[model samples]
Target: MTSSAIIQNIPCTLVTGFLGAGKTTIINQLLATKPADVRWALLINEFGRIGIDGALLKGRQNDVEKPNTIAIREVSGGCICCTSQLPLQIALTRLLSEHRPQRLIIEPTGLAHPHELVKQLSAPHWQTSLSMQSVITVLSGLQWQQEKYRSHEGFQAHVQAADVVIINRYEQLDATCQQDLLTWIGTLNAQASIIWAAPNDASSELTVAQLSMQLNQPSASISKQRATQSSQSRISLTLPNHLLTNMPNAGNSAAMTMDDEPPYRYHDEQQGMLLAGWRLPSHWMFAADELQQWLLQLPNWQRIKGVVHTSDGWQQLNFTPDSLTITTTSAQIDSRIEVILLANTDNSHINSKVSKNERQPLIDWDVYDHELMALLAK
Candidate 1:
């Protein structure tokens, strides 16, 4: 291909990880440092129907001096590689054609099937126009401690397929655990560039020049190594109803669709995991002290994240086994929260009366729901 042809084709990168693994944090950091001249687009697929990630990323374009430098799209409520392939294709093709970004970054829902997803991204139809880049999977050093992360196929596939694994919160690991992590990486034989970065460091940013290389370039196999769905299946796409539209369910239930309503809620379960999320109206502010108290008391959930319009301001909250933080955000949108818990809980709830051996839903949804709703400002 000619140099001009190569330049015209947008380079794409897939950032995949497990729940609460810091994928969104690292992507935000990359956008914060993006070059002033490069045009970019970001497609975010989240497990929840609420589109919380998209809302968090909405203010990112303002971080750049150039307007419209970063265009955002969402295909929430399902995994892009399997059930949501058509939406992923539609959103992606539109991102490339309309925005004409120089580079594209996709943050597939953490629960996505990475290997199959990559195979879809690297398929034959995209060979000429889209240059794939390194698959970067952000991982918390603590993930290894959990048997769930070690045994889960989706989590394993993410790390195994990555060309770069940014082990965030690496500082927390001791000499032995650090070595163990390295050994596990070696066992995978993924040949990925391991970036040991502290979660707070600015050094983990992914650069445009780094992602724009030709897939055939010696080091750029990061591109040659990825995959995708068939493009021949009518990919006409417009992103009108982006939230809670295609979210998945654990069993046979259909996904719910929320009108332009406040306080929308959704829950789903699959692969022994449960995802619950809420989207509250902007006016539904909460007291910071009460919020913190309530959140701190609910520790059984595997992960929790949201940006709420609190009395203090718009605050972003993230909680995982590895870290917890509540910081301010400028993203002006509705308040939202996403909580994920392992479904195999043995009476994980604080108020649970289930016998020690009897399994129950990770949390008593009715109870927590009432508590959180009570915290909201009337």
Candidate 2:
């Protein structure tokens, strides 16, 4: 709890995790459970233009008067660490200058690098204004087993860069799997404090008794010994295969201007939209056992998800870009998996690929399930 000598403001918590690892869920819970005496300001960064997360938090603040206890600022267009860091600084300046909330909670996009983001926030200028209280990373259980995601750079970085690692979906893992995960985590980041957290838990089991080992001290001391600039990487936007296909020039899914809202409202006309997706027909059916087997066997794919159609109905499958998650949801009946990818790639490449229809997958679409399975196996 070191306070800055120049500024008397409290430090902020930078909550980061890969996509859908439950960063928002934990933040929402923390906000709900925090003492009423403390006020909070939420800053959410998203990859796309649509600020859905901000809308969600605002919806929950219905009872608060306009300009009250909680305030949310949405930074869109690119990952927070990518193009939005300066904007984040500006926002923090305004918040500190005006509102001066007790706590500043920043939820970076799932793909953001915590070390890099923290470096920016802890700059000499911002030091007086804000300090980092913690850097928490969340992980999904099944991701390690998925070959496609096993060695994923982002997922590995997420685990490696954490001060604390929170394992989500703990209830879904078997005892042996859980133990194996713990062993694997120990080998990866021995210094990180690992805690198993479920969505329903009111209090994370990270009590003083559970944290007796004091795993993160060495990492902290080591970090203090090094210069901050040593940790940052050269930032750039490299679109994955899925995003390349949605470029305005790519195919049927061209970038449409915001005014042209017929097909679907895209964030930018210059950068239509890129969705990591897979389409399956309704005729295909997998029983519970079959589904579990398929999920366990699927290759690693981060932000890997698609709509799945089965004899029973339509459903959605979601996973981390590192292949950590293999979850099925019946909430959407279309049975196709479509994850929204960001429009942060170079505009030139996007336009070229979209206009030329050159981004089509090499695999045939007739028997997509088998073709997909074969592709993933590679």
Candidate 3:
């Protein structure tokens, strides 16, 4: 195809899922298997300001010398659907104009609503210029069984808007659980093609033909109005100063860079949720058993996700009100954790039960830090 033709009709695919559903894992697989002849651009969004996902995708330690074929842009501190929409558009436009990539892949923050993004791309201005491909939503098999996810409106919106639903970590489910998951997904989105696959294994099933599937429903008109409405929220956290002072440097100096900046304090929100996150040195390894025990006693956070350095190896942690899954995975840019909390709910009951003015803490950060220090000392 000629340059003008390619620029006018570049195929863009949107990959979305709830927090820690392995969307990045799928994206990485697709990139690894991409045709050598086809150039691609990647746009990643994160809820926190530190941009861990971007760093990981760009290959942090060698970011300066990374290849130029795959253009990457990250919009951090908020969802692309709301506060960062303008930035997203500018970055996307610039990426396309400069890189002239044949394919574009977008990984929106897990908390984002798909309808808003679809509406943006389907608008009159971009309708003729960009060819929107199948909107893929990844689901965790374990998370599907949880009532919290089943009842969430944002989660339902993602399912309803997707053209292809890929369920990751299905290997963890039994025959009965697998059947129930498929049944539930069908009830919510009968038009979408549902595929069962493991993380990093989706590329085999998500072939070019499968990704070319067209949307069954028209973009909803209400999404434009919803996009303008703000659901801003905030999370307040207190971490021990001693933990930051004593952490060691990462073992692999060439693999990643440990950020010295303090934890982010952003206030923007998405889907009625707010995030509080911390970036820890990669050398700060957690005791596996103690970490799991602490997670069990974690307070009422709506969602939690991070890549941690454990005594055994690197592990990915995914947590929700009803489920928590920890599986060994490769090391990321750093050891970091982000907790998402519901901001619009009343905390009167929690405060009264705990103390007259004390609110329910998300996690005992001080205790966690102390435990980590002791673990590293041994």
lDDT of each: 0.68, 0.52, 0.64
Candidate 1 residue-wise lDDT, 45-144, digit = tens: 8877667767876776566656777899998776778785578767877777667788778899888888777777766556666667677888777787
In candidate 2, what residue range of length 10 has the lowest lDDT sum?
A: 230-239
Give the alpha carbon lDDT tens digit for every residue of 24-118 in model 3: 66676667656656678888888776576566556542445545558788887777786655777776777777788878888988888778777
What is residue 167's positional error in candidate 3, in angstroms? 2.6
Q: Tens-digit lDDT track for model 2 on 244-299?
A: 44333323222321232212222221122243333222332434335535543433
Per-candidate TM equals 0.78, 0.59, 0.67
**Clashing pairs counted in every model:** 13, 22, 0
Higher-scoring candidate on TM-score, 1 or 3? 1
Candidate no. 3 TM-score = 0.67
Worst 10 residues of 1 by lDDT: 230-239
The worst-scoring run of ten residues by lDDT in candidate 3 lies at 214-223
Q: CA lDDT of 59 in candidate 1?
A: 76
Candidate 3: residue 211 Cα off by (Å): 5.3
lDDT of 1: 0.68
